[model samples]
Target: MDKYTGKRLDGRYEIHELIGSGGMALVYRAYDEIDDRTVAIKILKDEFLGNEEFIRRFKNESKAIAVLSHPNIVKVYDVSFGDRIQYIVEEYIDGITLKEYLDQQKEVKWKEAIHFTIQILRALQHAHEKGIVHRDIKPQNIMLLQDGTIKVTDFGIARFSRSETRTMTDKAIGSVHYIAPEQARGDLTDEKADIYSVGVMLYEMITGQLPFEADSAVSVAIMQLQADPKPPKEINPNIPDGLEEITLKAMQKNPVQRYQSAAEMLRDIEEFRRNPSIRFQYKYFIDEKPTKYIDAINTVKGTEQPVYNDNYEYEEEPVRNPKKKKKSTASLVITGIAAAFLIVAVGFGLAALLHSCSSGPQDVPLPNFVGHNYDDVKNNPAYKNFKFITETKNDSSQKAGTILGQNPKAGTVVKSNSDVTLTINAGGKMVTIPDLTNKTQDEAVSNLQQLNLTYDVLPVEDANVTKGYVQNTDPPAGTQVAEGSKVSVYVSTGSGGEKVAVPAIIDETLDAAKKDIAAAGLTVGKITTKDDTGKPKDTVIETTPLPGVQVAKGSSVSIVVSSGNKSEKSIDIFVHLPKNVTHDINLKAYLGNELQTEKTVNPSYNDVCQLTFTGTSGKKQLTIQLDGNKYQVYTLDFDAGTFKQDESYPYTENSSASESVSGPITPAD
Candidate 1:
């Protein structure tokens, strides 16, 4: 690795020092002599280069990203092989590893975690747009730049990602803490897997602990494949409930259950930040056994025991005392005492047994379930032995406690040998309602306010629903809640979601135009260069559909910019014109265009101009051309009386240019 360091690599990049070492390769900080920038060079370990499969996968993913020039993703600079060194050059980012940052902080602040998560989402969203998925998303592969932006790296280096460009197939066992369930199960990993991994990372960030841990890597991996760790709230109850829900949703064990895309994750995080009380979680029991719960209840219910005194034997009157044997009077006295003792013992025992039963059942044991809901776990007849009142309410928002509502609550005494009933908290009922009326839009959403109602603010075209007025409800007004309830209120979504037309970007520099395009929800595509149109070539000049046209979200617009260059040779120029037309041609043309003109070519009035052309007396060809290529040919029988005043040329059509060529030609004016 050092041999290539400090020298030109691939005859262009000047190798520098060893930056880091990964499982498959060693990275070096290098300088691109041609591009004149620092880059991270990753060279496959010498031994692994021999493995053709690994070599293929390594090259394919790298190439996948080389074309992905996204703001949040590390840019792949170049890829090449020489001297048994298969190296990939990427954008050199100066920053700390997300893992290192997490380790140093030990616990990321909620705001910081959210901000970091947002960056990751943006990166993933960008990847998804390009049809790529970063399967191994983890803290180690993320870098927090000095300026605090997160750069998602190492995506193109995963072994399990089966991107079409992958070159190798290896037994892929990802890091235990970050591997998604599907990957563990040897299922095809996709965007969902990456979403799960990000969720795990966020969990670790806020809780300062991995969701699951075991003695061996394999064990941890297995747990991830099959189990969910205790909810984030359990680890750090201080974490906002909303954030926990987002985390759980992201880490859902089933791919179908997890977030489908990074954009969705971003939306959830934003929602959670807005309201942390809403968390998504499910309960699970230890070893998934029903008996574990029944046994727990035994201690409280005391029903499993057939009888407390069954093991004891009652032996009445042990043949008086030795003294009684000598004296018949002593025997009589011992009998009287024994009879009294028996009477007292029997009376107290019977009374106590009756009291215990009358006081209600004993408290039942707490069933061990981490993420289940009440209705789901309730009614296991095994719980009948405990003495506890059951209360089940709509708490769809909360993971149902295995013993939904336990008597003795968590730890209380049951009337020994009694029956207990538990009322569990059920997840809230689902509903769709009419609009909220008269109340402020914000205040109108009484649906989810815990009165067995949950209402969402619906967007409607209206002048109503001012801050306090209810627009409308699903079930009209006065609908009952807590049972079969759902309401939607149309709030005054005033002046929102208005579409904006993409502006002309042809002549503007790439950087300047990119910012505007992205802000408008438009993407830049196919950047190439052509010789100057006399404007600052390569600069944006014009875009499609003119400007100010209202369009929907994520519209694709093309920018025709100046190349800021001039063709070295004057090639065949063709004039594209209507055939068999002769008229006064006052063609004031421009051969070389300017950048300012191109940038605002169609910006407004006075920005349009013609290309350079000459209306000379050339009877030989009588042809006009533009751009020196893509030409049109015509035979003009110029019968104009005046050279300057006469625009009409007695142009007769030549059969045409080469039949193979399909282009327009006309008289040169």
Candidate 2:
């Protein structure tokens, strides 16, 4: 057994076992006694205790996740930094690593890959907006839940945008296969590096292989810097062209050519999802300068060829004709006399034209009219030269008659009396609200966004409508309202059952508490009695799931009643046997200091067995031993109705009978 296993830290977290180990830290599944929940504690390794760099990275992970709060990102709960021991407590995710899942599945569909990529990008977008760059992103660092949820984890090497300092070992510290070109080259990196990593993961998912792989890490790093990956469609013929383009663009060698941000990449993916056949106008190789076309129809062997240039003007080269006769002396004198007469006539025309232009209206710069009343500006004597074109819009946020916008904009030089259009606010505009009944949350949100309105989602219990679908909208739908008004969307929690908050029933009589529970739409469950010195017999104590916790209507609410005398309570627990138990195995259940039940069960008959225990009324320790190895534990509040099982270790078929299991474990109701 590890040293930290079975130990309590700060008298609060009871560490069960080491779940994972990284280069600088070890993760343990621990129970938070104070919060009454399980959390994963990441403690710095003893070997790196003296290393300041590892310590810094460990602390940085906490700081990075502290500011980030997203559904697709792992959440941090608490941090403890002591001289000898430093650890961060985070949300315990009951899932397997993405790397493990991929290894097991071998091949993933392109659509499924896209679904995963979209979630990862959403998480990165949230982090990037907060100025945090997740420098290390890979399948190994991602957690995959059974419900197809993705959680990005492991920010030990993340960088903040505020800091530009580089560490000593910065080159390819993240996996070389997924690092961006700039990252592989040890160049300064930002959120784009994370995007590049995501692209690599997506490529791997669709192709079932890495884009660039070599015998050594150094060779792979070189490929990341200088090599171009084959298009995903080439490897997987089923991949869509739009998705392949999006992947390659995100994995571009040059940061400028890559998707600038996660949100930008998400938009492209969303478009692809909407229309699979749609192709984006993303040309990878295009001339920066305009192409020049050669002039045709101008080919002379001896003389310079007359040609049309870029400006589209025709120029003719001079050709000498020595053999031609020259009778120009007499003709030149006549031409000069005619030219002088033409110049005199043109001079008179120019003088007349100049005299006409000097009398026209002069040009003046337009003035700004925004934030001012249109009626005042139009009637002012100083603004009498220009013509006012009025356009009104309903804007409840702006004052009535105030100019909301202008056409010519402030400084455009226009002739006097030119038309200037001014848009004025007419107090408020009325828009007919669209019916959002029975629509999904996303559909309703999209409709509201298109109407230039905002919305708030409120989940309510509706027995008729399906969960996550809209039940109704505030202001009821189809009512005329302002364009920018906020609509309240009441979404259905579920059908046939509605959620209700558990009422506080402590200190009430058992009979009265049962009435309250029934009034709250909850059913009274198994009643257990506890020995109490202060409270009267049959007095109400506490209930399961505590107070204020939201539970479904008609759900069981177990009650613990107080008894003045010492009373014995019995509990029935279901035990699931491990798959490795091929032969007959010994299973024992304990209550407090004594063993309650011992049974020999064969695996072929039933994998699960029911264990019954009887103990004196009070809080007692409950342990399950399989083949003489402690496999599970629970705190039996003989007083609190049914037994409360501690989820410190969940059971799985692949788990060894001697070892506690992790990952997905569906509990019995």
Candidate 3:
């Protein structure tokens, strides 16, 4: 039996059984006797009671969860740090860990992953706002209920930002597989580290594998430091590009580059949910002149350096022929007079040109062309003198070829024949839908995405096509459809047979029950047995989702069987006479102090005796007397049907035999 089972603590909580165990504590399913409610009590291990580090971690978990009250976070109800033992009472969660759930699923669908991740982010967002950083955020610490609710647990290494002192040791904590790069390096950690861990978990959820893995923890940690994982899309092509970008952004090696907070990441997830095909254009700046090392060089003296004259000009001056002679002053005067006459004539010609420019065409006010048809505007007599420059763009909100925007105001004045730039809405592009019949879900999604189209999967029961394969698409294949439109892909759900009623197997034998269940298209699941006097042993007492209830084909039916009544029990006892006894002696026996039988035994003939006893449902006391002296006292627990000798006299001088002999002792019988 466990040490804590059936034990009561502080006269209020009664521990039932050990539910889980960890390195520092043992969790028990305990009932609060005072409040009449069940809770999980995490008791510090006896071996670690004196170890300060273990004690601190145990207390840290209690403190961390005590402050958090989110729907997705586990709740702590009470804490006790006694002299002999310490424990924390928390809400009992009846579910498996997320890690186990993921293992069973192998690969989670992107939509399901997003659902779980959104809940987790909401929890983290609350925690981050409260200044708590859950240093460990792996799937193992997440609990998944049957209804798909998530509960984040195990805050053993959590830290509070408001606290001045470090609650955890300097050594690297948390699982190395999902720890952030800074955490692996034992660097200062903040909320962003938790985001990194969440990103790793999301990657694993969608890709069915961890971002980094190796034979040893050290190798994995090293990979966390230096290696860049392949994007989730490469592993699972069905993952949306926007989701992949969000995941990778959160997993950035530099904390400064990752999502600044969980709320930011949640916003991106919301955007992805609203428009699955939406892609975020994220950009990061890279320093072109990154620091580098250079070779050492010898020093130069000031005189060794090249010098240039400040007054020197590098341009060459036009040179004159040395043989040429200068002209006379009178000839120079005549040339100057002709130059003056040419200047006067050029001034009069420039005045005539200015007078002609002043008589140009008049300006006109440009009309609004944003919503007007391009053809109408081009043929309008009022705008015949103006030029129109059109650019086309795909805008789903507006009609095809409609002018969306214009550069200048409608009332702005411009010269005739001036350019008027306009942006036209070209609407959605049309593309021929490829044949998607019999294609795998991933392959179909990839093909649709390549054509700038989105898809919705509708799973149908198909007896011919395989599961996860496309049976056919809506609008059929080879049909022309607008780009960015949603296509319905009919996915096969395998051959799900007709639903059948569950047959009643109560009071039937195990083999018979199994046959009946199989005949009803169901299999046995989690058979359990209990003591029941109403039914024979190995007979089915009851079943889960009771008989006659309709269930899908191949569903499992759990059953409980009878292990017989608890009252029917019997035991045999054997005894030997003492060697010192020389004469014939009378032996008497009593059960529960009531006379049973009396007999005489001769030592020379036989020295051993055998007896049988049967009873109802409680412990029975057996007493034997030899020659009127008490020989042995035994206890027989009729409930379990086991016997043990309490004490033996071994033939003493005192004798007190009082019962009448029922028969003469036969030879050793």
lDDT of candidates 1 onward, in order: 0.57, 0.75, 0.75
Backbone clashes, each candidate: 96, 0, 3
lDDT per residue as tens, model 2, 473-546? 87887887666667877777664354676676777898889899998899998899878434798887656755
Cα-based lDDT at residue 429, candidate 3: 78
Task: Provide TM-scores for the models.
Answer: 0.41, 0.43, 0.45
Kindly indicate the candidate among 2 and 3 with the higher TM-score: 3
Q: What are the C-alpha RMSDs, in order, of all predicted structures?
A: 32.1, 32.2, 36.8
lDDT of 1 by residue, 164-234 (tens): 43221112345657978656544456778788888998888888899998776555655776665898878
Q: Number of the top candidate by TM-score?
A: 3
Q: Model 3, 551-577: lDDT tens per residue?
A: 678888898888876756666766668
Clashes of 2: 0
Please give the lDDT score for candidate 2.
Answer: 0.75
TM-score, cand. 2? 0.43
**Model 3 CA lDDT for position 105:** 53
